[model samples]
Target: MSKVAIVGVVGRTNAGKSTLVNRLVGEKVSIVSPVEQTTRNTVRGIVADPRGQLVLLDTPGLHKAVGTLGTLLNRMARRSAAGTDITCVVFDASQEPQLEDVGWMQRVAKEAPDRVVFVLNKCDAKPFFSSMFREAWKEASTTPQPSPVKPVWVDCCALTDDGAKGVMDALFDFAQEGEPLFPEDVVTDYPRKLAIADTVREKFLSKLHQELPHELGVRVKEIAEGNGRWAVAVDVLVNRPSQKPIVIGRSAQTIKGARKAAEKELSEVFGVKVSLELWVKVEPNWMKNPKILEEMGYMGAVI
Candidate 1:
């Protein structure tokens, strides 16, 4: 029988979790950005391998909570770890273990999942602290538990296919014999609207850089579909009026550029001619608004 497993890909923010998931799925199922908290939702990336199928849940990276949204993302990450066949905790081993990294290790040690894979990502970076991560894990495992948790350790770069192959192998090895969770041709089950929103947000993140990443939010209001084409209406949320001009840019250049780039990527991703209508709205403290949060799909189920 072919093996199948649901793997929870969790880690601290910017630990290369999204990159690794995309690499493993062999497609861009999740949006990637160098900005922290780039992934605001739990995206499911399905991998159809010859050995079987791996349902990878790419969750929001754990981060220091700042507002309602930040707390929700952290909760989503921790919750995603439960009820999975395998817990895949990715770490940016290029740097020494941080507090969040140790927090994950401690949780794993205490829970003692049946199968765990600790990925030491960014192995290509200089001063790779693989030994330091190992020591941290050792210290974390000291937490009292019913039994010892022995995790499969894999060094991965995540930026290249060759570097990510070990992660795929390790996940498959722990997979049990079962039928595939999704069809072979299907790579991801991420909602279409959310995918579009993520794509748009990613483009904006690239343009804005550190300007207002944490405060910016994108919500797809509607999608008008016709003959092989889609006209999507999106609301770009900013905390203050001052931030609105920054996102819209001088003479609307920034929003236009981000829109065109998002359209191009969405067209390719959905195999349709995609167009975007972006409306930049200053929704003072939108992150803390429960109604806006639900509308943005942040309050929805994991998958």
Candidate 2:
């Protein structure tokens, strides 16, 4: 019988959770950015081997909820952890543990996730919080564990694939005997349109700093395939008219830069030449707009 593990990967914002998922699965199925909350949905990336398969759910990094979208993303992250075969909380141990890191530790302590794994991501960098991370584990695991299985710890660098295999091995060791949930060749089940939107947003974020990314949203307005290339149109949604110029930049340099980069990456991902058109529109207070949120795949989150 083939064994299977449904693993939920969670962490604080920019904790390298998405990078970890892509590394483990041996493919890019999640959007990664330095910007906080780049991942806003539960993306499942499958790992296949002769012995078993692992379904890794890469979720939004937990952070303080500021609006309906923020609340929904947090809930989605926490929700993805529940009832999984294993829960992996990734920590950026390179720096001191932030309140968000502690928040996850406290949550797992109280909620007691089953078959937990504590991942010290970014092992390539000096781990200043090494002791604190261990201490957090001791504190959380002190109370009744969510599962009889003692939590496993692995230190890995998500970007370089260093120690990433150890994480996969640890998960496979604890997997349950079951049939595969997806085909062996498939890497992810994320929607194509949303993936395009995320691709655009990621490139856009790469060009900016500060709170701009948090205030912007990307939507694939249209997509069409022809002889040898994909014609895609995207809208960059800003919260205020004042913010529009920032996205488009002086003489449209920023948007042009963002578009070219996005198209290049999108082509590589989709295995076909891609052409992207970008437009910036101001949607005041879009974070609170239910219709826009739903369009962005917030799952009808009513907060």
Candidate 3:
């Protein structure tokens, strides 16, 4: 019988969720950034192993939400947790897991207890783990509501290729012997348009630091065929006018450089020539507006 595993990779912002997915798939399917909350939605990567096919669902980092966008991202992460066959709770090893991690687990414990796996990521850095496991067990035993089952612990590093393959091996054990979930050759399920949008967003995250990453959003407004190429227009939304100058950089050189880099990646992903147009506009605290958040593909009940 064939086997398929729906594995949810989740963690706090900058916890290497996307990096781990890319490492597992042996490709840059998900965009990686040093900034927090780089991933705004669920990024799926399909790993075709000899034993079974594992569908990896890389979700946005779980954190406190002060706005509609934050809430939507949290919902997406939780939703992936509920539906997965195995949940990989990725925690940064550089620091102890915070109270929020415990809380995240408590919520998941109520749903699929046994399907969870506590992954201590970034092991190459300083090693500090929250006694999250002990605390989680205590909470599970004491809680009045029935829990699914207890999860296992798998520690590894997404960078430097440390222990990542072992983590993949551990994840494969959770798959059910059923039909393949996706085509064997497919590495990622993201559409070309969405993928381009992600590339633009990633370039922004990697280039911008501090609050800039969180304040920015990207939308592909147009994609048209040119002479043997595709002409693309993208809108980069921000919350303030002051931020525009910084993103545009001195003489618009920085933004121009970012645009060129984004275009090259888009061309590779779509296998066609890409012409990119970038525009900056103020959305006026779009993160806080529920309606705006929904319009940006941040939906309800993702968890």
Candidate 4:
């Protein structure tokens, strides 16, 4: 018999949740960005250890919602934590705790205090405050939790993959012995279309910085496969006509750079040669469009 568990990786925005999941999976299942809420979907990154397997759900960081899309993402993140067998919260130790971090602790303290793990990420940077966080959690948990045991705490550097194994180890201890949920040799089960869109959006986000990371979206419209090569077409979505030129850039340089970089990275990630094309389309408030949100995998298809 083997052991298996579904571990929910949750944290506040820009908490390195995606990076740690990719490290644990040993592959790029989720995209990483310096911008907040880079992960807008619930991505399952499976980790196979000699002990068993852990299905890690890389969820969007919990944040204040400005629109319907933002609300959906926050709900997904909270629901992921509520449904999983274990909850692992990643905190950026490089900075002090924020309100969202306290919010998570409060919820988990009242809900599943014992079945939690605190990952003090960015331990590579100094001035560690893991002890302070632990004490805070104790105060938060003791009131509502019924004689809860302390949650496991691990120091990790998600950037360099340092001390991440310890997080997996702690999870394994909590994982019950059972049959494996996923086969070996599979890193993630995320949809291919969404993955491709994420790759393209990642490059776009890298290039544009603070300008449009929050408003724009990516959708892979078509994929043609033949002769061991893939032809992929993607749409860059913005809210208004005015934002179109920014995505296309001066003389199309930004779009071209984003396309070239996306194609190269996607080729490596998917383990196949890819020919990619991009188009910028204006979708006025597409985030509120249920059909568009469904197509983007932000929600299940409407019945």
Candidate 5:
């Protein structure tokens, strides 16, 4: 039996956590977008190799919890680090590491001092954000450590596939020796319902403006599988009425575009013809509403 490995990928919002996972798995198990806080849940991507199997926990970026959802996401990221054999602390080489980044890493490492690896991502740094990260890393290197796990630097570019294999090798080195964590054919454990919902939400973020993207949430209201096609219905939840127009766009173009893109992607994910039904709902302050949050699959939203 191959050794089992749980590698936790951690970093700030928009630091390419999902992209890196896609690279290792060689498939798009996790959604990737330019928007920050794009991921609000812990997604698992399983990568199988000849020697062993690597089970990766691609978590929401470590950040301050603004409301119910943010708090839960932050908790999820921290909790993801607690029991994992390798805690990969990812950062974008494009931007300087802020105090928040260094501070979060320190605290997480306090929980598992020996397992943290500092991953400086986006090494294909487009000039504007290139030089700034060195200063950031210098700051991190000097930041007082609460425990013995000093952050180790590893650079990678998910889009270009640069230095990514190194990151995988490093993760393997840190993983515990045991049997393969999952069967070879299984790439991710996300339930079809939740995965489709997340896919819809991901498309929303990718296509919508920054300010409005975070205000949106998606839920799969119903799904039915037919002979040659799967029928799926999803509710697009927004916190306020004003944001609806932005998502819907002029003549509802934006909403229609988002739905088409989502349907295409979800079809590929399920490997069949997909009939997607989309509806918009105004869930006043849903981000702060416990019931709504729980219904959205954020069971830990109250943390």
Candidate 6:
């Protein structure tokens, strides 16, 4: 018999949960960016090892709710953590524990999941606050619960393969004998439209940096697939008219660059020639718009 488990990767925003998932899955299953709330949807990354398989749920990092979208992301992260065979809580050990980290600890402590793993990511950084996180976990676990939950703690860098090996080992160790959820060759089961949108959004995030990242949204409206090519029509949503030009860049360089980069990555990801038609639309408060959120797959159930 083979081992299998659904592992939920949860943590604060920008805490390297996506990076660790990508590393563990040995592919880019989720978009990685320094910008907060980079991952808005729950992506499933399938890891097939000699021992068995692991279905990783790469969820949106929990952050303070600022609006409808922000609150949704936090809710998504918390919901993902429930009902999983293993709850993997990733922490940025390079920095001290934040409010979200403590919140996760308290939740785990109170709920008392059967299996849990506490990943201290960024262990390579100088002045790693591993002890602080342990102390925080201790404080959180002191709260009375129905049953005591003991979490396997592992240090991970997430930037290199060797750094994330411990996390993979710990997860497999907790897995039980069962059949694989996905095929051995498949790396991820993320939806095609959402995956393409995430790739396009990642390019824009790289170019835009900190300027209005949270305000930016990418939604793929249509995809025309041919014998060996795909023409994707995407709507890039901005909150205000003033931010539209910023996403478009000077003389349309920004949008052009983002499209080109996204095409290249999408082509590689889908193993076909991918082209993107990006339309920047200024929709006031698109984040709060229910229809827009559904179109972007934020309102949909996680697969």
Q: Write the per-residue lDDT of candidate 4 for residues 50-102, one digit (tens) a residue.
A: 89999999998998888889998998888888767888999887777778888
Residue 249 CA displacement from its true place in model 3, Å: 0.8
By summed lDDT, which 10 consecutive residues of candidate 2 come out lowest?
Answer: 140-149
Q: Kindly list the per-residue Cα lDDT of model 3 for residues 1-303, writing each as its tens digit.
A: 867888889878778889999999888899998887888878889988788888888898988886878877887887887777888888776776566677766776666645667787876775455465456556754587756666677778887565797688788777789899787789987766667888988887767777488888887777888688998888888899999888898899878888989988888877888989999888889788776565455663442
**Alpha-carbon lDDT of model 3:** 0.79
Stretches of candidate 2 off by over 4 Å are 143-149, 300-303
Per-residue alpha-carbon lDDT of model 1 for 211-270, expressed as tens digits? Answer: 999999999999999988999999999999999889999999999999999999999988
TM-score of each: 0.98, 0.93, 0.90, 0.94, 0.91, 0.98
lDDT of 6 by residue, 57-86 (tens): 999998889999998998899889988999
Candidate 5 per-residue C-alpha lDDT over 238-274 given as tens digits, one digit per residue, 9 for 90 to 100? 9889988887889988888888898888778778988
Task: Report model 3's TM-score to 2 decimal places.
Answer: 0.90
Off by over 4 Å in 6: 144-147
TM-score attained by model 2: 0.93
Candidate 4, which segments miss by more than 4 Å at Cα? Answer: 143-149, 301-303
lDDT of each: 0.94, 0.85, 0.79, 0.87, 0.77, 0.93
Query: Which RMSD does model 3 reach against the true structure?
Result: 2.5
Tell me the lDDT of model 6 at 248. 92
RMSD of 2: 2.5
Question: How much is 44 displaced in model 4, in angstroms?
Answer: 0.5
Better by lDDT, candidate 6 or 3: 6
lDDT, model 2 = 0.85
In terms of lDDT, which candidate is strongest?
A: 1
